[model samples]
Target: MKYDFIVVGHGLAGAILAETLRSRGSKVLVIDEPKENSASRVAAGLLNPVAGKRFAKSWLADAFIPAANAFYEALEARYGQQLFFHKPIYKIFSSIEEQNTWMAKSAGDNWGDYILATHTQSINQPGIDDPFGGIMIGRGGFLHVYALLDLLTEDLLKQELYLPERFDMDELQLTESGVKYKSIAADQLIFCEGYQVVHNPYFKWLPIQPTKGEVLEVQAEQNFSPECIYNKAVYVVPEGAGRFIIGATYDWRNPDEEPTPQGQEELSERFRQITSKQFKVTGHWAGIRPAVRDRRPLAGTHPKYKQLSVFNGMGSKGVLMAPYLAQRFAAALAGEEEVMPEIHIFRYLSLYYAYTDQQNQQP
Candidate 1:
């Protein structure tokens, strides 16, 4: 095989992993099929560590956030493109209890430098509906995920390391050495096909519960500063040029990327709940997130085939976690380190066994 590894899908996870491997001197070929509703393309790409109604910090936030910033910074330096932003996020307190919790956490210096400013009263931003006040979190921001993907795709194409085609499983042939797909052979193949992995015969048992989400790009009457992100029930991210990204509505039952009226209404209402700003709905888009049952990434080699592997299930925290996890996975693939056990594929080995057993019983 001419390629050391072949990566399927060019979304956020796949692109990062391929780049990590290439940086470590591995010959990589990335095959991608363009999906209009790719989550990475439409993602708001927040880098926030503080999350949820509970106002608790994200898991490994202190570690992952810095890794992501450094990774994106390196990419920007190489590509000469601004792919990352270091905007402060203002999380509006929903109730007194949440505000008090922040107070307690702040007293313990739990947030470190990530906490920029805490207002006992409203942050005093115009049009904001923060009656209880808000917390400005620093050392975090958002990633230009779409831009990063485009830059990587262009680079791959220039180097003849990228193939633009849909992966057809029927054409795949596993061998004693590795595997071949449509005459292209590699030492190993990793699948990062996102929510579509359910259709992959080899990875059928991966517990990826696809969740459909919709986001709206609204044109605010007053331009929101790109230096800050506002969060309430949902997040309102400034995209420069008076455009803001208001999202997202989560639907697990239908994992397709079809934008609906209900989603638009829900997003619009949620934005209203955070502020009294009127904005024109400029764009509406949707994508399916490859959220796992346990809310963690899925990595490591296949149980039955050493030549096959998967690197996906980024879920909602892709922007914050992908870079760190990608490097970790690359090291694991090279046998230089062990993959995070909590997210290793072996965790779901029983699911694969049960699936195979059912198939055998049917015959």
Candidate 2:
């Protein structure tokens, strides 16, 4: 079999890239072995405009938000499935000082577009108490990641474009013309292997500070509406029908992809802080996010092998970042425009080579 591109890994990165390439009339073969603990599959799919302790508007939020909306809307129309939902995020303020900090930050010109001037009065939900702080953020919501992945997988299967198997690097050959797989040939091969990039022989030198995040699903009371996703120390995302997905504890030291008892306990404790109602833990899962040291996505082709490329390192923001970057990556692959210098793999080429040289020199 021949294809214009062979994409390894069918997670969010691979799926979005494959779809983008196929939409451009290119033949693409997606090879993947769905890890039981892959991040995308378990992602809460929260897209927040403001992030972190400072409540800073996400980097490139102005562009990324609109692009994300357009991309998901188009996907929903094409697949006849709802992939994105607009839900205002209710950020709870823990203290008066925190509320003051948010208000101070909101007054800035750069933050004006993303933050609201006044606190929200509508409590939306009754069980959770918020006394000191409240804010309704616009242009933030949840992507139905699981449903989107399922829809994409089904569509790819229907089109005979998906291969459900692990890609053995040993079987790959870099030919003079291009890369060769078992029997398939491609003009270019790209790896969207997510956090597993640490295992890629070619890209291992790229500094990926991967982090393990754990989340839990709890059965909530029937009164809470599934309209909004609540966020504070932990986020409570409504999963419909008296169930809410709560979680996320970031652990950089323990990078394993398995859920731990401590992680579950931490999450449950955080949940209890926000609500008095008793809830039962229905599910718990953990995944490794392919976070970079500088917290920006890595893209573009290998320095030594132009035919090989990578589109990984969207980190925690894969839901918001994948679509736009996938389009840009496709353009870069097609040689339509120069890849963004800041995010290109070439930015770290010298450091990577030096590291590899050091490894070779070591006993």
lDDT (Cα, tens digit) per residue for candidate 1, span 309-347: 999998878889988999899999999888899789899
Model 2, global lDDT: 0.84
Best by lDDT: 1
Question: What value does the lDDT take at residue 123 in candidate 2?
Answer: 66
Off by over 4 Å in 2: 110-113, 120-125, 359-363
Clashes of each: 0, 0
lDDT of each: 0.88, 0.84
lDDT of 2 by residue, 46-147 (tens): 898888677788887887888889889998998888878788787888778888888787767466545543563436367776776577777888888878
Each model's RMSD to truth, in Å? 1.4, 1.8
Residue pairs in steric clash, candidate 2?
none
TM-score of 1: 0.97
